[model samples]
Structures are given as structure tokens and as C-alpha cells.
Target: MVFKRMLQALGVGGPSVDAVLTSPDCRPGGTLEGAVQILGGDHPVDVEYLAIGLLTRVEVESGDSEYHTDQEFHRQRLTGSFRLEPGARHDVPFTFPVPWQTPITEVYGQHLHGMTMGLSTELEVARAVDKSDLDPVAVHPLPAQERILDALLRLGFRFGRADVERGRVYGVEQELPFYQEIEFYPPPPFARGINQLELTFLPTPRRLQVVLELDKRGGLFTEGHDAFGSFDVDYATVDQVDWVAKLDGWLRQAAQRRGLLF
Candidate 1:
């Protein structure tokens, strides 16, 4: 979705700007190519610069409460010191590299609920800058990511929800300000001992950091709490590992390690 608005800084008769993204669906570290179209108004305008900003919605925890906020992570200048004549049509094309640590917005072609991402355009006409147009964008997981998710689904774990948190995970190297946590309901055999499961993936050029948090169920003599486990896996193992069995084993071990199951 794209929204367009006249450059308010340029006054009522100023030029209008529209940003169109060629590829709305992209993966992390991929190149996003798009063109910013500028339509001149009744007179010539001195456009100082044209820029694009990448925006996403993030959750922040404040003391005893949590709230959602809009964040702009990336920005670039597409054009500088350009002149537009009356009724002139100009297109400035741009290709920007997405950050490698950008959060995943979709999985298995399904959009994650409660996530909103967009590409916003900024036009500066003689210091009358307008940042009103925003284009929605979608991000998907990589090949290795798909393998892990497939493994979980094959193990009978159902998708509970997915969200982005504004803090870093313990003992993990992160580049972005936020990370994605995908939660799932436990399957049978382990369901009796575990309340919920949360997965966090931090990917690098060569390997992926997998963090698993299990909410253990309590018994008459035990108290309920969370059990955290982290490991690193190479991309080559995506096809080599028997993910279904491996994931099942991981869950069983995690439950036992936390004393959830005897």
C-alpha cells in the first residue's frame, strides 16, 4: 500500500511525491529497488534532496507495561540538488541494501500478525520537506530458516503467535535494535509438561543462532518457570539433519533439564 501527499513544506501549490517499490517482498540483506516519482506543480521548484526511509512497528516494555511504537531503521538519499520545471515528471531510481539483521515479517507465505513494515519517502523542496508517503513491505525467511520452521511444524507444534521485541537476547550478538520471537504451542508427549515454547533466530553470514525458551508446567511439588537453551547451526545442516526427530529430542531434553518431566 502506498500513500501520497503534496509537499506541505512547498505550500499548497507545491510538487507531489509518490514512491513505488518494485519489490515489496524481500529477504534480509537483499537489495530493494524502487523509483521515486515527482510531479511538479504550477512553477519550477528547487528540490534539494530526495530520501527514503525504512520503517517498522516495534514493541517496547516500560516497567509494568508494554506499548507499540513506530521506528525508522534505514534511510538513504536518492537525489541531490535537482531542479524541476512546471509540470515536469521526474523519476529517481534507488537500490538500497537491507540490513542483515532485519526482522522476519512472514513465514511459509503467511504474514505474521501484529507486524507492520513500510518504506517511506521524503522530498525536500527548498527546505520544505514532506514525509507523508509510505509503502508497505513484506519480509520472508531464508532457506535455512524455512528448514527449521518446517521441522517444528512436522513435529506437530502449532503456531501460537509472532512478535518483535525491542531488547537483545542474553548471550547473543545482534545488529538490529529488535529481534523476532515466534511462539508455538507444545505438541503431545511434551505438551503435558510444557506450557508454551518461544523461538528466536539470529542469523549471520555463515550460521544461525537459535534460542529456545520453554515455559515449563508445574506439578504439586514444582513451580512453573522458563527454561532457556541456545545453540548454533550451520546452513549446510538444513538438509542433512532429521529436523523432526532432532527438534523432538531438543524439546524432550529441554523439559528434562528444567525438571519439568522426571
Candidate 2:
């Protein structure tokens, strides 16, 4: 019994946790259903509570530098308290709401390079080491988002990599502190003046706030600088809009002519 307690303290023989998702794939603003399966340790243990949260790797900027860290934004409490009897197994069901502005990790069934997310199960154990596990999760894009992305692809822009940048997009009603940047290489037509295109989305219940950052390429006599633009689209009318022409017009008329202000 003493040995068992020692092992439990080290979490070697303590309650083990495994997070199981009903489906690994979900769209932004959707729900992910899952269960936290817990198996008793070698001895009985008191569990304070069970919680599940969504976490992702984000890059945070510091003074003249940036660093990456895991960020957890959404969590759901499973239970107030529970007892794990020796040699027993329990499953705690959960339904976690994916944030409306959750970053897209996959597009059309392909993983976005450099994007990742996890569903982490954390068990609060009393007088014992905490037990937890992290499960991979894939968040897809919404229709409006997909339409814009497809429009970019149609424009000959190639997908680069994506990452979550720390700090909010100024002037945007950003609920979450971080924003996702989907990078793309400018096609041949604009490659002379455009270095890259970075896209971000902040979706509310009624509309999707899209931010575009244009990285300009410097020529012999000019210096390179970044430009930004913010726009909104009604979720109800996303499908009705012709994304190709609309996005093209936005890039040409607004970004090139007037320039996107930071």
C-alpha cells in the first residue's frame, strides 16, 4: 500500500487520463463532443475536478523579439469532485464550444502547415499528482473564410504557412488576445511589388471581421513596408457574394490605390 501511494504521488500508478473526441474535425464556432476517460490508480484517490480546455501554440511578441508558447483559451469543467476507486474506470462526457474566431488548422481536408491545436484533459487530484492528456484537434474554416481562401487560390496565390500571433489586431473587435495569420505567396502578376499576403479573421455571431496585411516588396528606389485593411461580411450573405471579383477588387482598389492603414 505504501508503494502504491508512492507511485500514485509520482503519477506512475495514479489515475490516468485520456481525452477522446467524438470527431477530430470541427469548424469554427462549432462544438466538439468528447469524453475524458479516467482509470483508477493502484489505490483509491480523491479527484477534485475534471476539466478540458483547448490549447494552441502561439507566437507572442516582446521588446524587439517574439517567442512561442502554448495558450489555453476555452475550458469546460466536468465535475465538482469525484472518487476514483481502485481498478475502476470512468468516463466524463463534455461538449466544448469552439470559439467563433478559432484559427483554421485544416483547409479542404489538408492540414495547414505550421498550425496545430489540442484538446487537453486536466484532472485536479487532491493529495496526488495531476493526471492529464492532450489530444490533437483540427479546426476547419467557415464558408465565408473558405470562399475568400478559394478566391485567393484562384488568384494564383500559393498557401505558405500559418501561425497564431500574440497581441490583438488593433482596431478590430478581437475577443481573443491572439490572431491567426494565414500566409500566402503573391502570384506572378503582383510579385514585383507584393512580397506576401497575411490574412486574419475575427468572427462574431453576425459577421466575420477580416484583416488583410500586405507586405510590400521594395524596389531600387523604394523601401518595403506593411499595409493593413479591415473588412466585415455578414454570415448570411457570404455565399451570395462573388468572392473572386470581390476580393480582387478589394486588393486592387483599396490596398493598391488608397493603401491599407495599420
Candidate 3:
């Protein structure tokens, strides 16, 4: 309680807030249930508002350089103005909806390197400054997402790292300002032609949109370049397709410089 309390805004005696999540793990399009526990300070104070949101680190490209910054993509207001008496505690329950395009931060119980997710609670006092609290959150992949990731592993792609970028795919439809890229090293078979592979998943309630990017190695006659491919899968038919064979074929085509339009 002491660590969760915000003592700077209202000095030694001010309202403090802590967001307690029932569970820190969830998938996209799911709901995160939690309670906002607010404890009054030594005196009565007017609360301006209470809110919670999903926060993540996003990489932003500026000119020729890129930087990372914290971004709150989704938010929910818990309550409006309220009055708090001395030493009074209030618990407000909330159900925060995770956006469909929210990035995945964990897979197979492992935290993806360079990726982070959190639920942030913000409390604004009428006359004092804003008090805030943050709790780490783990975003797991949907069933369809898991299938594709498993396919990549079966295809011998070693997981490299993952990151969220603050931009939209050139031809993909996205509801959020940022998207995630999971990087992997090519298998031995395709290592000579393909240097690296990157995967991005944009999922909805009914369908999952997948985008693939390949870093092609330079040949004696051609220069190194990148190859792109996009496709969709219906959630109802996710298990019908052989993702490993599909991905291997696509990678082979891209490695041969034939075509990546799938």
C-alpha cells in the first residue's frame, strides 16, 4: 500500500490510488477486470477524475533517427468528480476492454524481448497535481496467433526479438496508431538467401490479418532488398490450414525472388 500510494502530488497528506488487476494476463479483444483502490489523505479533498488505460512503449521514427516513448492507446474513465473524507478508502471496480489491435507481449510463457505492457491508473485532484500508478500486464496471443508463431518455429525460424513501432503498415488496415513486429532468424535452408524474417499480426473478432517481411541477401547480380506479403485467415478455419507448409512455401518463394504475393 505504501509503495502504491502517490505521496508527492498532495504532499504527505493527499489522496492516493492503486490499480489492482484480477489477473495480469489477457489477449487482444478480451477484457481486463480490476479495481481502483483510492485512499483519502489526512484531509478532505475534491477529486477531479479517475481513469485507467493501457500503456506501452512504442518506437517512433524521427527523420533519420528513431526513439522510444510511452504511449497510452486506450483509456476508460471510472468516475467524475467526487469527495473524499479523511482516511476514507474507496474501491471502484472496472472492466477495461483490450483493443483488438493491441500488441502481444508474451508467448509460451516467455516475455518477448524489448516489449512491455502495463495498465496505468491516473487520479487527478481538483487543486493538487495528478497522481498515477502503473501495473505490469502480460498480453498473450490469440489461438490463431499462437498457430502462426508455432508454424514459424516449426519452419526453423529462431526468435530474435520483438518491438512495437508507431506507424501503420503501408497497405494493411489498422485501428491503432502502433503495431508490433516479431523478428526471427532464418533457418539453415533459407539462411543463404533470407537474412531475417519479421511477422506482424492484426486480429479482429472474426479474422486475423498477417503480414510478413523478409530481408533478402544480396546476390552477385542483384542487390539486397526486402520482400513483403499479406494475407487473411478466418477464425473459424484457423485449424484447417497447415501453417508450417504455408510459411515455408512463402519463404522459399521470397528466397528465390519469384513472388511473395500471397
**How well does each candidate superpose onto the true structure, as a TM-score?**
0.89, 0.94, 0.93
Q: Please give, for residues 151-254, the per-residue lDDT of candidate 2 as tens digits.
A: 99998899999999988888988888889999999887767668899999898888999999888887687788888888998888888988889888888765
Give lDDT for model 3: 0.89
Q: In candidate 1, what are the lDDT values of residues 145-254, reduced to their tens digit?
A: 88888898888888888888898898987888888888989787778888888888898887888889998888898888999998777887678888788888888887
lDDT of 1: 0.82
lDDT of 3 by residue, 1-262 (tens): 6543455344568878999999999999999998999999887888889999999999999999999999999999999998989899999999999999999999999999999899999988875677799999999999999999999999888999999999899887799999999999987877877678999999988799999998877778878788889899789998999999988877777656643222
Error of 3 at 200 (Å): 0.5
For candidate 3, the TM-score is: 0.93
Q: lDDT at 46 for candidate 1? A: 84
1 or 3, which is superior by lDDT? 3
Model 1 steric clash pairs = none
RMSD (Å) per prediction = 4.4, 2.4, 4.2
Q: Rank the candidates by lDDT, best first.
A: 3, 2, 1
Q: In order, what lDDT does every prediction score?
A: 0.82, 0.87, 0.89
Best by TM-score: 2
